[model samples]
Target chain A: MKNIFERNVSGMTERLSRSVIGIAGCGGIGSSAAVSLVRAGVGKLIIADHDRVEPSNLNRQYFFFGDIGEKKTAALRERLLQINPDCVIEAYDKKLEREDLASIFENADILIEAFDKAESKQWLIEEWASVFPERPVISGNGLAGYGDFASLRIRKTGNIYFCGDGKSSDASGLCSARVAVVANMQANLAIELIMNKTGDVK
Target chain B: MGKITVNGHEIDWNDNMTVRNVLDRMKYSFRMLVIKVNGTIVKREDWETFPVPEGADVKVIHLMSGG
Candidate 1:
């Protein structure tokens, strides 16, 4: 059998290496999705999250207690690089505004909207559609409390993937299991988009 | 009237209705959700131009996060 890196993907990996994806949040859904995309061989990843890894985040977020107080985007970048040394990971420990959206999204083949705020998520949907109409953006939702993994679904709005319901993360209580499941769903949708596999929707 | 299903709920659809337009008609609050039409996922870009055919089965799943 061929070694993993030496394996032939016929430029699939090369093309993906050249591709850039922007993920707005690095919390529950964002962090988890980032890990998956890294493992999937996505070329480049841009993570933007102003929040720091907190003790509370240890339960659901990917960061450890040791990483507490560390900016989510920065920590995620370090971790992802540890796994895929060649992958280019960028970290932005700041919020995204209308002007910054374009720059952040520039050259990215796909955009993953994982912001914790519903308003910001809306901003991505509108801005990407109006300004960068050709680019594909995926927004996540409904990953809160303790719910069955079956509840999560992936649907396409145009080129954007709306990965869940607008269910408030504040619904009752938040748990790691819920966030992990939804984040995986979001990551799966992104991979499928990158692979051009659209025969099925999850 | 055309018939279609959204998020498991069946509803009436109008002629030449795009997914975004239908979403608006249903007051789906698009920001909080994703829509699936006839097993194919429709993204935000296709909302205005993508047409929903008659008797098409559509599903709209909305996401919510609980604290």
Candidate 2:
């Protein structure tokens, strides 16, 4: 009699156990993504973000009110443990710098770019393509404002899977539903990538 | 009139134009943003059919990278 998670993902777990998921941001999308990946049974996660929880984030972020002001990486790491104790969660509570890119991404099977800053987003994508060409990275956009959720499109770009709309919440204040919808999709994309569900040619 | 480029070509400017209109004219379907306009950062909302005065300098950069 094992947990539902363990039972449902046993096969995926064995495969994903060796898979390492790297997320660059732990705000709305990253936090929700971490939860989804844990539920999906990704073996290991490296969560990094240099921000603290704010009252404004509580509306969309999965974190509770009590967790406000806490560092996002720490909270994600702690909460992910509750969802799947066996899943290894590594938290790096700092902004991703170019120097940290190679070492941080050394073992990642898949990378999730959830950074809120546009400049950081550009750098990570550029660096990964040049330095870590083999690893797959998933990036999200356009989960902001109140638009038709149907507009969300998941596109594949080379080794990168561009999730959601590729738009910024900063441009259109993020709503709970939209954030959840996009983040969930991103998580599912990560799971599919790990499970080889997308019929990847490579 | 200043030249605004997307990908590479200069875009025509008019008061009637919006960001979406400009994007439509460019025939670009890829998600665009994390962009710069003459070295200045422009928001996505600004790309939504926002009319540009004559002679506006522009540059469009995509959000995701391959590396």
Candidate 3:
């Protein structure tokens, strides 16, 4: 009983379905990555964010105009379930503190650091690495402005991976095209990490 | 001059060289960086005092993260 979605991602669905993914933001990267993961048949997602959808966020985020003013995690969860009614999404509309991140995403096999601030990204990664030294945490970085898309890439050390240009400053402004590319790269890297860990499981 | 490897390339390392010295020497101005010295992670606040022993393997990774 494979629908177009499952039939298309035939090889990955099972392993992804057994995995629980955690994303720490629902802005451009988190929202876009969450959509891709759910569509790829990741069975559950634990997403958290303190921001609400802003009208300007439509330029890069995966939210519709009507979603403006709604909490991002909730809005994204709704959008995800609309695509796959069976997918279980736990959307937390709050700022994730150090302990909150550990308790909330305890079951997540992998995590995505999708925040927009440098300090935030660094601290989030530190907390995750401190708690789950073995689990992989994927991130998107240096994706600012447009063109030179080829410069974007995935860089890693131990279990922490970054997918982006590695030097772009956010002052250049965020654009839809480049943002989507990095967002998808984060999602793709998450899938690769998960598959590598589960390849021998099933 | 002593030596150390940073991101796989060996570089001149003076005695009592701190992480800040290595970062400044390498001109890594990127605001976000994850640095490891001899397989042990260095906290940002300790970069000034943390010592890099001679021949230590250091990884000064520049990280860029945003939406």
Candidate 4:
């Protein structure tokens, strides 16, 4: 019998199945990116988050009503597993520190920064760049509010790919559509990096 | 008078115009910004002190939070 992802574009299934992605911060961006990657048949994922699902998250996060109160990493892991039972997933329900990041993400081929706080995002990029200088990190910023989709763009700086408008904030509010757009952009970049056979930074 | 490029647009610059001055002059009120001068990151604390050289390229990227 053909596998669930066998029909995927030539070489995509095999390539994605061999990749391992690490996601930090299982919020709107992290959960959405996780689901997209899982659906694309990625081989493995390592996710970490200290937050719990709340009613507020339902508006934009990829969580069900039943997942309320559950730790984000646990809830997202369950959802991802339901989508792809064969995919290996490692979930951590704790905030990751700088010293612990390298070992936790040791096996990951790529890292995705899905943090919601500016300080956290800055910390992740700096630490990731210092610890895993060669690995590409996909991050999102300014994905709040609505409309002005044209401002949302993918920016590359060094080994990091930032996907978002780089401007919107909580003052303008957050919506599901805009958040998902940025999250999916990050996922798409991750997939592209994984599929690049030459392994050169694109 | 000198000129510096900000996000690709050439803007008039005055002597001793720091990153903070440019943002104020341009009326960019965003609180969260990642400012860079000539490809080097200028931390938020240094924006008031980091002076932009003539013909330098300044990129002011705003960062927002949702996820």
User: Pick by DockQ: which candidate is best?
Assistant: 3
> Considering summed lDDT, which 10 consecutive residues are worst modelled in model 1 chain A?
A1-10
Q: After superposition, how far is residue A25 of candidate 3 from its true place, in Å?
A: 0.7
Task: List the candidate 3 regions with Cα displacement exceeding 4 Å.
Answer: A1-4, A198-202
Q: Candidate 3, after superposition: displacement of residue B21 in Å?
A: 3.1
Candidate 1 contains a number of clashing pairs equal to: 37
CAPRI tier of model 2? incorrect
Worst lDDT run of 10 residues, candidate 3 chain A, spans A1-10
Top candidate (TM-score): 3
TM-score, predicted candidate 1 vs. hidden true structure: 0.72
**CA lDDT of each candidate?**
0.72, 0.71, 0.85, 0.85
Stretches of candidate 1 above 4 Å error?
Answer: A1-12, A165-169, A197-202, B1-63
Give fnat for candidates 1, 2 and onward, in order. 0.37, 0.08, 0.58, 0.60
Model 2, span B1-67: residue lDDT tens: 4455654677766556666766677776766354344434445545664555555555554663211
Mind giving the per-residue lDDT tens digits that candidate 4 earns over A1-202? 1377876778888788889999998988999999999988888999999999999999999999999999888889988988888999999888888788898988888999999887778767667766776888888988988888999999976676789987677678889999999999999999988998475322
Give the per-residue lDDT digits (tens) of candidate 2, residues A56-95.
Answer: 8888888888888898888878898888888888888887
Interface RMSD of each: 4.9, 8.1, 1.6, 2.4
- Angstrom error at residue B16, model 3: 3.6
TM-scores for every predicted model: 0.72, 0.73, 0.91, 0.81
- Candidate 4 docks at the CAPRI level of acceptable
DockQ, candidate 2, vs. native dimer: 0.09
* Complex DockQ per candidate: 0.24, 0.09, 0.62, 0.43
